[model samples]
Target: MNETNDMAVARAARLDTATLSDALDRLGIVGQCHKIKGRDPEFRMAGRAFTLLCGPASTPPGTVGDFIDDVPPGAVIVIDNGGREDATIWGDILTEIAHRRGIAGTVIDGINRDVHLCRTLGYPVFSKDHWMRTGKDRVQVERTECVVNIGGARVAPGDLMRGDPDGVVVIPRAHEEAVLAAAEEIHAAEEHIREACRGGMRLDEARRQFKYHQLQTRQ
Candidate 1:
């Protein structure tokens, strides 16, 4: 697809995890939204994807920069750091460069640093925790462009990632169009349910009337 077409597709598909979760009930990929708690309660980022694979006690010097340099302007970086809370995989300096490049936000299955800086820079980052210690000592890149785990979800390079203060969700590239369609439907249904509740319908009655139970029954 051309740049314009790509942008349009991305725009249509981009959504916060809550919307996505409501839609694709079976596809929920869970992770803590630790980095966003004290900051903006709502956050959004749009892009295709560029994934990173890092591990505890593993990244080489310059690895983070090299990976960021290679990522395209409108791609999200999914960093898999094995959920290590001791070291931070991303920091203020990297956030600065990423913003300059117009890169989409980051999703780290690990910890991050410079939380205040990230918030000020308006960069969306989702992580498991926050720490002052850097990754320099405990983490290094074991592989790039390789499959990595984010809360048990197998994320690959080029997959679609949508994250917000709610959480993060990974949309496989092959199923992007289908998943987005589902997410849209899910969001609409949720709105309908919300309206019902506001109209004084009982919670269980509204849920049942809206077929909310079906959301969990998808095979």
Candidate 2:
């Protein structure tokens, strides 16, 4: 809705992707960014999506990342490169610019290079993988601020994305409130179960008391 609302949602979705994934499953909503992984295992990110679609290079070979100038701060740059592993659509220069601009992070269906800068700056970049080959002549920007598929998840403008050591997950703008609520409930139940166990309750008893097994079951 607004920047304040987005930040609040982002903060609530801070739970690791695993917990959010369980919440999505419980709600029967598909938001997991399957096969996409963070470049650095410890890297973390959360922000609204600013999608970019990429296709095979055209006759004139369109630009690789001039769109950087247009991305708003606190928005994640989501690039859909058709999962091409041979060429990378992101690199150091873009990472530098994104970090300077306070952009949240970058997620790609393809690959990225110049990761040293990302690692150095703590600018999280998640993708299928990374490679040295540039996409300058192999791919081009097809569009921006439109829906794009990352990994297997469809991301639209303003959709919330959260990433961690586990992986990335997209919360459809329309489902953000529901997903966040579910995840919070699940997290609290888990904490209760742990506390019960620590207080000498049997693991099975704790789980049953907390409904641990059903936390992720489809409702």
lDDT of 1 at 16: 58
lDDT against the true structure, per candidate, is: 0.70, 0.90
Worst 10 residues of 1 by lDDT: 30-39
Which residue pairs clash in candidate 2?
none
lDDT of 1 by residue, 6-110 (tens): 854465455557666554554453322333332345557756657778855533454444577887887777888888888789998888999889887887888
What tens-digit string does per-residue lDDT give for candidate 2 at 1-219? Answer: 586667655665568788999999999988999899999998899888999999999887898899999999988999999999999999999999999999989999999999898999999999999889999988999899999998788899988899999999998988888888899899999999999999999999999989999999999
Cand. 2 TM to true fold: 0.97
Candidate 2 Cα outliers beyond 4 Å, as residue runs: 1-4
Candidate 2 achieves a global lDDT of: 0.90
